[model samples]
Target: MSWMTLSLTLIFVFIPLLLSKTLNLGLERDTIVAALRSTVQLIAVGFVLKFVFDSEHAVFIMLMVLLMIVAAVQNARHKGKAIKGITWKLFVTFVVIEVLTQTVLLGLHIVPATAQYIISLSGMVIGNSMVLAILFINRFTAEVETHRDESELILSLGGTPKQSINRQLMKSIQASMIPTIESQKTIGLVQLPGMMSGQIIAGADPVQAVQFQLLVVFLLLSTAAMTSVLLGFLSYRSLFTERMQLMKIDVE
Candidate 1:
């Protein structure tokens, strides 16, 4: 079996036993089965990506990239079911990060004006962007939901929606970007990041690979931070109205 398959199987078999024996925690057999299903899905994606990269066909690459974006948005939106305006939040998050990451890559000449370059860069940034979007969406939505009465009070006292939820907005935005910022701060200190270490081990010059990894981190930092803040603002829009009334975005 391929390494990926072998690893997937090992994880499928090992995780539950480890959880039960080491922590006495239970994800249930159903959870373990679901995790294995995800592994199978990823394995399928690996095959599709190989075809996309090798084909160098614009249509194929675009389709693959679009599929990836759909998957990402679905994942991010799923976590924010309480945030009534999930679709809008997802659009803002995806669009902002896509534009920012694309601009950075093209402007910096990190990759050529080709499908391969665009797809690869977007995939990397999108992965980080999804996490950022989910983090901001969940927290911002929950905070607004919890403090909704306070927001109404503030509105009655002459505060705009923007002004009313400013505290929670800032909090969620900050919380979303904390992981990205901390990863940036701690790389090479607390951990040898995957890309850099992998490049070095693959016989590339250590210094050169480190430089490439730095550039990746720089792009991810901007992509993740921008996505979090933009998504948070978009989510805020559905929570309040022009008349400063709380808009009930019923996820159901």
Candidate 2:
């Protein structure tokens, strides 16, 4: 694509701004901020990726992946601030998801051990897992708040914290994972995902692009399940006090 073509993409941005203005949605500022941030971040990432691709050192790759995980944790931790040690919980959850996904890819030789493949796949893995983690936290917190009485009743009836919150925990995990599952179910028919479309535009064989897209979708599904279940189990306990009573969460 030429500079003109890239510049013309701004029209897409105008649609959102126009709708926000007409509807008085108060999203103009947010839309502009998001567009600007996305532009700047993608440009910076392009440079960093270029340099990493040239270097191809294992240590550099590890450092980059770790940085991505830290960013994911920071982005997700706020959603679960009511829970103690949420940052660590997010960090561990992302690390496990990323490692497991990468291990499968590399161990099975599904993808070549190239910087581009590793970094791109890692972004998808960590990004989806981060979103799932945030969703799980938000849902779990809301469920706990909504069912506080039921939880307390369970506790009063000699139920353990796990038993008291198990329903909410399962509900939260399922809620967070459903979108990923549903999207995958309709992936090919509903839309061409960015990865596949980008590859096809770059002149890759359509069949090859489809194969890669399928792999990514599978990875995302696995990540969605792992992130939700692992974080749900690890985090539900934080909602209870040592005396097995429900802790009051103060929403800011």
Candidate 3:
């Protein structure tokens, strides 16, 4: 698309802004800010990705992946600050998700190990994992707070820390994973995913685009499951005292 075409896309943005202004819903500022930020960020990332894709050096590729992990962890850690060592917990979770998914994809030769494929897939995997982590942490902390008395009572009755928090932990994991699972159930029928639609728009064969999108769908399924389970297990222990008592979480 030309610059003029891209500029015209602002009409889509203006629609929301007009609605917000007409109804006095107070979303005008946020809509404008979001549009500006997305425009700037996508343009900047496009340049960086072009450079990285052209280089295709292992070092540059690793750096890009590392940058993604760091950003994901930083964005996700705030929701779980109540959990001890949340920073490292999120870091480890993101890193593990990246490594594991790349290992499977590269190891099985499912995708090329070039910067283009690696960075693209890593972006989706890490991004999905970050969202899942945030969801799990948010739900987990709320669960712990809501069941604090019950957990303490379990501890008082000689239950282990793991036993006391097991229900909350499981509930959080399941809750966080439901969105991903449900979305996949209605993926093609409900809506064409962005990646698939973009490829088809770019004139790729419909079948090929669908195949690639399916690969992404499967990758995200695993990403959702692992993220919630790994982060949940890592975080739940921090919610307990050394003496097996339930610790209070100061959720913000």
Best by lDDT: 3
Please, what are the lDDT tens digits per residue for candidate 1 over residues 119-227?
7678888888888887777777777777878877888898888988898899888888888998889899999988789788789999998888888888888887788
Clashing pairs in 1: none
Residue 240 error for model 2, in Å? Answer: 1.6
Q: Worst ten-residue run, lDDT, model 1?
A: 243-252
lDDT of 3 by residue, 92-200 (tens): 9999989999999999999988899999999999999999999999999999899888888888899998899899999999999999999999999998999999999
Off by over 4 Å in 1: 1-35, 114-116, 247-252
The model with the greatest TM-score is 3
- In order, the Cα lDDT scores of the candidates are 0.78, 0.91, 0.92
RMSD of each: 3.4, 1.8, 1.1
Error of 1 at 172 (Å): 1.5
For model 2, the local distance difference test gives: 0.91
